[model samples]
Target: MSARTTPSPARTAAFLTAYDALLARWPVQVEHLTVRTPHGTTRINACGPSDGRPLVLLHGGGATSTMWFANVAAWTAAGHRVLAPDLIGDPGRSVHDGAPLAGVPGLLGWLDAVLDQLGLPRADFCGHSYGGWIALEYALHAPARVGRLALLDPTQCFAGFRPDYLLHALPLFLPRRTAARARAYLDWEAGDGPRPDPGWREVYALGYADFPATRVVTGPRPGLDRLRSLTTPTLALFAEHSRTHHAPRVAEAARRALPEATVAVLPGLSHHHLPMAGAAEINARLTGFLAAPRG
Candidate 1:
């Protein structure tokens, strides 16, 4: 499916300007890379020692690879080589010049190609929101390629979206969607607590209205059997105040389906604030789970 069309030059510049300012806050050296995949040209932001344990990060919808800013510092400090990518067809620099990756296979295919080109045979995987769903599917689809899996408040993995979420987010899909509405919708989701950085928030809203083919390609939810049979050690973390669905309900389903996985909810977190909130705790849980040796 085609997206809203290429963003205007002015709008694109605005996003980059805001994005660059936020990126300057990264604590360590960061390398910007463009890799070829069957799906399109993928933009990746990488840091940490080149020989450290490889860890790939997939950002939630409307959040480009830049979303990892909070966790990348701690993760890299722990000696993880972090690779965060702008999902093809989402906002940021990735270009969807090839045929649309129509189904789940295509989504996994894109990631597969990315790693192949990067010369990584296997690596740990972590994703947030929609990206989490993709990471889960990828781990299940290609278990051997994945060393471990970490999910952050993923949607459509263990439970369907809440009706209220769709109702509030409906304006984002309409042709009439505007930057103001996008900003307001985000404000609604964030409620009283922390939200994105002011500069990055502007960038996200511009991309949300200007970026094309976003929030598309949500394939059917992963099968329960596949989930139950998953052998890859997993971490399923949810937002306590997530508006997407009942957090406890999803956590219960995760326990039932992937009984061996580490599942918990971060207190005071809402859907949008998930990755940015409780950075120290989030970093600890993620680093600890991923760093643990397999039994």
Candidate 2:
């Protein structure tokens, strides 16, 4: 099967350039890895000691594993081995020859293949945005494979995307998306920061430019009933200023539904850049949760 959405050659080249440049700046040495699964070959960047407890990182839509570049050291510093995977279809090195939106079964299958290939029976999971949604589904589908779960301003899980956020991002779908327009949209989404490095910003723009909106993976919103029954330990982080969802409502839903969950609303963060913006705070909360003893 061909990819539901494939980047044009030009945009792909540009994104790869920025991606390489960004990865080169990672604070710690990382091992590039690939795992072959039934769905496709998954590309991963591994860090920290081999024998350390496993921690898997998943990036959001229109981004690659590079999303975790700012927080890898914090996770690794906590004596955990980190594995950040470039999710299958959204503008990464991962190959997606099958339908990108195969719903829960397809996603769980791919994740299971990755874990099996890496010899990890269970690992702590931290996901941002779309990655968070994937992590949630994986935990529900194969509860045995997920040890602890952390969601960084995840979208389409506990709450739907905010209307204004959706309206503001509409320009991204225009056939003639330009770098300037894309960057502006990104800046608007990020709201505040030491503006991401120029190269990284361009990479974000090119990645979005290359990816067709139709193929973006928005995981199923398994209702509150299913969420209430989850047994996995979970940490749900929402951005106070996010346009992805009403932060308080999402947090409320998380608190109300998940049996074992801690919901926090990080102040002054937007949906797109929550992971990268408050890296220190986010990492602390994430590693702390992951390090806690399981019941």
Candidate 3:
């Protein structure tokens, strides 16, 4: 509530500059939009053919819409209109009023308002990490508004978070040593992939230092029966080496629970590398899922 912390102006400026540099690498026609919700405002980046099937992309916590840079081109090439919204209460340009969203209910309300303003009654959803959890919640809360769901290493949706994750993350809280610690954590997640680009890495660290930290309310964990009840076409990907949870267990549970869904544990991948290590493979899988005719 009341923004856990406010980013300093200087740090915000630096973050924005680095964000722009990362965005510049991907050249695509985009329409910037602002949607008004009852509680706050959301910023959305729209791309692809105006008449194509609507596909909403949601980025993970601590990341913004720009996180989809690697996947957008593939989605657009598959003839789907893509909309990436910066989750409010994160480091993005979206702004909220007095308090951050109060868990799932607030999140749904904000999303509904944004969709309404975009003139979309229903759309396919693609989300990564925390955003994936949000998409799963949306599918359950407002089933009719979701055509299908694609979750990329979503956290705390299929399984509980591993306790050791916090222990490994403790170094990130230190002020003076945060950057190095953050980079180490990210590197661990990235596995064998080369380090992230300089500009992107710099912005990530700056955002980590400056962005207002907010509570991650992992609302009620739905039972397997609950997930099984949903009929929406679903695709859930779990990283084989994810530090968030036991990926193999989660993948198995997902497959057993959601009989109609396609679930897989990606080999040699982790949460953060979902957008990098096997980006093209993930994009192809997603595009194929979206393109298939629903039974």
TM-score of each: 0.96, 0.92, 0.92
Over 160-261, each residue of candidate 2 has an lDDT whose tens digit, in order, gives 877888898788777876777779987887665446557667777877766554545455598977887789999999988776688999899888888478
> Candidate 3's residue-wise lDDT over 177-240, tens digit each?
4556666777776656445656656656767766766665558777777787788999999888
* Cα-lDDT of candidate 1: 0.85
**After superposing candidate 2, which stretches have Cα over 4 Å from the reference?**
1-11, 98-101, 192-194, 211-214
Q: Model 2 reaches what TM-score against the true structure?
A: 0.92
Supply the TM-score for candidate 3.
Answer: 0.92
Clashes of each: 2, 0, 0
* lDDT digits (tens) for residues 1-295 of candidate 1: 4332355677577777767777777788999989987777989899999999999999888888887777899999999999998888888888887767876678889899999989999999999999899999999888999999999999999999999999998888888657788899888887676775676677678777666535477778877997887999999999998888999999999999998999998888888768777678889999999889998
Model 2 weakest 10-residue run by lDDT? 211-220
Stretches > 4 Å off in candidate 3? 1-6, 173-177
Worst 10 residues of 3 by lDDT: 1-10
Q: Which lDDT value does model 2 have at 279?
A: 85
- Residue 257 Cα positional deviation in candidate 2, in Å, after optimal superposition: 1.1
Candidate RMSDs in Å, in order, are 1.5, 2.2, 2.1
